[model samples]
Target: MQIKLIAVGKTDDSSLKELISTYSKRLSHYCNFSFEIIPDLKKTKNMDESTQKGKEGELILKHVNTSDILMLLDEKGKSFTSEEFSEEIQKKLNTGMKQLIFVIGGPYGFSPEVYQRANQKIALSKMTFSHQMVRLFFTEQLYRAFTILKNEPYHHR
Candidate 1:
């Protein structure tokens, strides 16, 4: 199955962009991996949090297919070790899923509609992280998971 990470806003930091790109290239060897940056909402400073979420939600929904397995990277979701994450990835591929879409929402988090549509939720950590930083971290973890799956030297047991 193909894997895609959909996040809001572009990475402005050159360092972070380079790191994310490095891992993304590594990931391509194992699975079809790609990223989609949903542009940050204009006039967000004047809009309420709910309204911002709703606008972002619409963009998120547009890219998702009905058959895609929607997984949200949420603060309240379940956390897993790298090995377990690899197993979860394996399960999805084994299930013959067409696409496994994982999303990292905007600053205000996901809308009610997005939450309702999610098939699963995953937490990277209990601590909070900036939306941009999370993209880098998540990309690294994804690369590590694939390495673990392949018994590569990049990941340690």
Candidate 2:
């Protein structure tokens, strides 16, 4: 299955971008992986939070295909251990999923429409993290999950 990570905005920190790139490359060895950045909305100071989210949601939805299984990285979503995450990925592969899209929404979060279209939601941690930081964390976790699946000593019991 192909795994795509769609996130809003660009990463400004060179250090974080480098780290994200590193993990993304490692992840590619295990699957058809891609990380896409949807440019942040311009002149958002004038727009209300809801409107900004709605606009961003449109862009987010545009990237999604009906056949793709959409998973949102939401704070209130299900949390899993490394092993469980690997199992979840295995289940998707077993079911013959074509594309798995995990989205990280904009500053104010996802709109109602986006929520409705999502097949599942996953939470990386209870602690709050910057959207840009989350990109690195998720990619690293994905790489780790793949290593764990192959019993490569990347994850512990």
Number of backbone collisions per candidate: 0, 0
What tens digits encode model 1's per-residue C-alpha lDDT throughout 16-105? 999999999988999999999998888788899889999999999998999999999999999999999989888888989889999999
* TM-score list, all predictions: 0.97, 0.97
Give the Cα error of residue 44 in candidate 1, in Å. 1.1
lDDT of every predicted structure (CA atoms): 0.93, 0.93
Residue-level error in angstroms, candidate 2, position 113: 0.7
Candidate 2 residues 1-157, lDDT tens each? 9999999999999999999999999998999999999999999989999999999999999999999999999999999998899888888878787999999999999999999999999999999999999999999888888998899987763
- How does residue 147 of candidate 2 score in lDDT? 91
User: Residue 155: error of model 2 in Å?
Assistant: 1.3
